[model samples]
Target: MYGGGYVFCEPDVHGQPDDPERLAEFEARIDRGEKIEPQDWMPYEYRRQLIRLIEQHAHSEIMGALPEGAWITRAPGFKRKLALIAKVQDEVGHAQLLYSAAETLGKSRADMVNDLLSGKSKYSNVFNYPAKTWADVTVIGFLIDAAAIVNQVANSKGSYGPYCRALERICYEESFHLKQGYDAFVALATGTKRQREMLQDAINRWYRPIIHFFGPPDNESVHSKQLMRWKVKMASNDEMRNQFLDAYVPKVLELGLTFPDPELRKDPQTGRWHYGDPDWAEFYRVINGDGPCNAERLSARRLAEENGRWIRQAIMNPQQKFTIPFA
Candidate 1:
């Protein structure tokens, strides 16, 4: 379950004007709901934004595995342990698929990894927090994966053909992940007093981060307008977040669970959710790499990179250049 991402300002989010005729043609195709292929001509801004979005998404998938992976050995039973292991594997595989999709826009996986390690790239902000207990793992599995499905399902219909196709498969596989997560969640919600307490506490701690998951409200957010115009972003942050609340809030309520916010409710009149401030300041700070687990997460990844360097070198063919994967 990966949290959502925000792009930094791009040409002020309006984008710098491209060549007039080509821009018209590109936009006309998008207006007709045509998919944009990797080999097709595109504005430099479109390519840059897509690369950043997909590469960061790839990074998030594996990184998102970490918080839950820490609980694998300590899982309550052999069955749960096996499930966590399989889920972790699925998350890593998702990363490989996303990296290949990003590569279509011309960034190498190596370069993407370097940018991540150097702090030039970002992943989901919610993952920078620690998973404090088994209940916390369940919260991440159910709530976070639920949130990811909302975002990913929407993006499955996006204009970038490779990214759209990748998301289609991803969204399909994610159903099992969501089901397993909900299974774990329901088990705890119906368990003994201490188990129930653990679940509630996990929900309390995760509520704000979960609220922060879809990112800040649209007006307070930064993104390229051209991406939305080109269908690269299928929904606004507010739209997706509201959709999550509309669907999942009742599920939580049905389990006698609650979010920390008292103001989190749906408006009958406007058909929108009203949520208290979740502290966008914290969201920005976390995304900028100052969160509780940011350093630890990166340290773990860096350790893996170092430990595997020799194997990479042994397999390297210096004369070979990367060829973009064919669909």
Candidate 2:
């Protein structure tokens, strides 16, 4: 699932002055609710932020696949194995879509990949934690996917036509993934005692990370008001997190499970959820590349890139001609 909304370390804005007439026109266009296209005149910061947001999202999709992809071979049955593989394939497709969308802003896929490899760009921190059991996969697929839907659905309505369009399609496929996850989750919840225990254990381990997934509270986040005005960032981290808890907490409790946060509760008066801080220090540490699986995830990605070098070389070769072969 897509991790939190755009929660990267903010790049230093080397803000350049735009031509006043062009800037006014561009702002007016955005104000009129028009999608920003690549060829359109825009402020440098807008382009920089869009590239950063989209590139991080694209990287997340690929890295997000790693934890779940590792489970395909060990899935409890053939049906689950096939489903996991298909789900993983969908995630890879999402990466391609997001990369293409970001490419419209002038960064190449190679540049983005290099940034990811060099630790200059960050992926969803959720993937930095290990998925220790099959139950963990189910929780990730269900709750994490649900959270992503909330974020993606909001972004789908934002400016930037290509990224919005990509999110629209992504949210559709994620609905199916959620169903698959829910079915698996329910089976475990209602299964033998051991299965139920396993599911609960997974939930306990993942709850903190899930809370962190949405990034820090709005008051603490470095997100800028200008991003919201530009429609680049559709919602605050707190708003999305509250929406997620409102929708999912009841469902989780209904299944006879519990959240790790005892203080988690909805305020009856104001209609907001209250919970303890999800350890922002841990979030920062993980984002800075100190999480349990960060090195492993990056190593795996690097190895895959190395192993696939020949294919990329062949595809880029000028003299190579496309061919169709009969089996």
Candidate 3:
């Protein structure tokens, strides 16, 4: 699944200044739809904000893999088991690509990883909820991945060069994930009564978090207009959420599934979705490390890091010299 919803906070604008002349050129470049490379002139705020967004995205991909990863061993058949493993592998690979993209902005991958482990940063809040059943995996693969594509496809148009390129590839791979997920979801929806019930339960359970996935409503978000001006944020959270609903709600209804939100509907004149509030209080709480699986997720990540230290040490050891052998 794609990582962040591109939920930005207000960037600190008081940092060191770039040359005023160079900065004007950079802004002009962005205005003219040019991509900003890593070594190119950029405002300090732009770099800081991009680092935060990309780092969170990288962290989200790996952490997002975990909940689904747990289901791999228990996947019902060989076909599913293989597909699930490949999907999870893609998610992890996305993290590597994203971290490398983030590194171009000057933060080391190690620093970002350390920040994630130390709780100095955050990933997507959607992953903090548990995947309680196999049907839940389908929900994540279908609905969650669908929501991510909306956000990512928008961000892919942003001015950042490497990050946008990385997103382009990631979005391509995620389309297949959506197909696999939708196939699984359709199977469950059309199968036995028990299967249908499981799918419904999963949908109900995930509806709120899916709504929360894109971050707060635009009016309440801490994001700055400067980010939008820089093309760092290509779409508002509310806009993306509406786009997801317009695209998916009918499909979901066609499957005989209902969202937990009773008031969900599109306005005739405005063509925008109107729904009850998704409980922003819960969103903030989950983001602050109070969600059902937050501790378990972080513990698993920490343990993995600790266990992998020896391999990193061995790879970096200056005292151990080795020569490549021909096959």
Best lDDT goes to which candidate?
A: 3
Per-residue CA lDDT of model 1 for 113-160, tens digit only, reads: 999887788998889999999999999989999999999988888899
Per-candidate Cα lDDT values, in order, are 0.87, 0.87, 0.88
The candidate that wins on TM-score is 1
Clashing pairs in 2: none
Extract clashing residue pairs from model 3.
Answer: none
Question: Residue 108 CA error for candidate 3 (Å)?
Answer: 0.5
Cα-based lDDT at residue 197, candidate 3: 98
TM-score of each: 0.95, 0.94, 0.94
What stretches of model 1 exceed 4 Å from their correct place?
12-17, 220-224
Worst 10 residues of 1 by lDDT: 3-12
| Candidate 2: regions farther than 4 A off | 8-13, 220-223, 319-327
- Which 10 consecutive positions of candidate 2 have the poorest summed lDDT? 318-327
**Clashes in model 1: which pairs?**
none
